[model samples]
Target: MTDPIPEGAQEIIHDTWEDGAKRSAFYTLDGQQVGYRSWTAEGQIDMEYGIQDGVQHGVFRTWHENGQLCELSSL
Candidate 1:
């Protein structure tokens, strides 16, 4: 199960490469990214990480809306 989008996520950005790889960013109303996810052309998750100051830097994690942990990594 995928996590539900965070409450108050006001802006989202999406980018797709020529190869069909995709990246998506979720942001707060103030424009701070709270989460990000990227997938390969084959539709496999390359990374699902968090952001601070528009940079991936901290305890990156993914979880379901029910609070099940899917993945975690520190950068």
Candidate 2:
């Protein structure tokens, strides 16, 4: 499961489709994006994807705060 947005986030960008699917990116207070998540209309995670052009790109992944891999996939 994707973690909640961290506290002291400096910025956030969010988009929602007509069908209710949503995507969001979270950044640290210092301005580096720390995470990305997407969810279906029903609120299930559609994917945990990478960021490019302020959106999901080729592959999706999640990482620990200490930089360990949490999850990764093309889907």
lDDT of each: 0.59, 0.54
* Model 2, C-alpha of 14: deviation from truth (Å): 2.8
Model 1 lDDT per residue over 5-71, tens place:
3556664658776775565546554656766766555555555655667677566666554456667
In terms of lDDT, the poorest run of 10 residues in model 2 is 1-10
TM-score of each: 0.46, 0.40
The list of candidate 1 runs beyond 4 A from truth reads: 1-11, 19-21, 24-26, 61-71
Candidate 1 weakest lDDT stretch, 10 residues: 1-10
- In model 2, which regions exceed 4 Å deviation? 1-11, 19-21, 49-75
lDDT of 2 at 24: 50
Quote the positional error of residue 8 for candidate 2 in Å: 5.2
